[model samples]
Target: MIQQYGSGEPVRLFTAGLHGDEWETTSRLLEQLSPPRTGTLLLMPKVSDNEYLSTLDRDYYTTYAPHLLRAIKTYRPTIYLELHSYSKESYAALTGDGRFERYGVPAYIDIEAGILMGSVSPRIRKDFFTPNDLCVSFEMPKGPNEQSLSVICSLLDVVKECWSRQGFVAYMSRHYPQQTAVAVKNYLRFYGHLY
Candidate 1:
């Protein structure tokens, strides 16, 4: 587990490697682990094991949901950052972090096109996916690509500016129509805060 510095406040749960193959997120989040910032932070470098990692399709919890769920139940974080690398692009790409409404944060902003949203669903429980908290599936940063770091940072900056008010499921349901509120609510009930 990785933490920042601080306590008694909203916490951010930064994670990577729901799919074992996406290794960059693991490296980045690992570097971020320090103490707790504000309330508490639980960082899991690789929630899924190598066995599942080698597979083509993977589920966040079913594959490695137990470990990740345990952590979430133990610590109810304010923000969940699901980081991963895009597989479609070998070098360059950019995807809009679309959302259901323009309230503030984009539902699924893309940090890097080359990254994929390997399986982050199982990590979130029903309660956390409420109106207050938000989840961002960040595309891993590209060292050099069609999209510059500055551009990605700007998008992230915008999300950061609005994250306090937006909800993750609302934003996602827009672009991914299948991501209904009902499904989100149901998923949370089954997989959320696994203490």
Candidate 2:
């Protein structure tokens, strides 16, 4: 269900559970739902609730792509964060250049040229990102462990702070010291090894 919270400008939209088994990510996104200190927060625990409830994996577009579009259009969020997880093969696709160790990080924020949606068109990507706006996804590793929960919590907290404050790069670096140097420029993307 989509729960609307908070008030004012800079509306924030967070979605999780496009995939049926993504309980951890869905729960984490729900936990972050609070009346924002300085803006609005729109939380969608499962965009495709039927798929999630059935516990049967299906493509997101087949079920409820309209719900996702409505959430974006209604909120017009200044920051849009989609929560997802990565399998071994999918993880390798991004870090295959050998710069990042395999499964080294708990979560990541993919902004550029990464597939965040299950089966949406390219036009939908524009909903999550716009110039001078924050658009990113929190990627968890396959079968999230205990550390995964902590990572999701911390990242969401940091994202909340960044929404209200300026120069959050230093704050983020202090919390996740293993951050890459390029994180400052592309602060929207946060991960343990890759930026």
Clashes of each: 21, 0
Deviation from native of the Cα of residue 150 in model 2, angstroms? 1.2
Over 43-111, each residue of candidate 1 has an lDDT whose tens digit, in order, gives: 676665464342223454545455766666667766666655545453222333232232222233332
lDDT tens digits, residues 1-195, model 2? 778777777777777775566655465556655566776777877665344432112334434466776767767777777676667676655434332243322133332233222211224443344545665555566666676656666666666645632334456456544443343333333221322
lDDT of 1 at 57: 30
10 residues in a row with least lDDT, candidate 2: 113-122
- Which 10-residue span in candidate 1 carries the lowest summed lDDT? 97-106
Which stretches of candidate 2 lie above 4 Å from their native place? 49-64, 97-122, 164-170, 173-195
lDDT of each: 0.47, 0.54
**Among all candidates shown, the one with the greatest TM-score:** 2
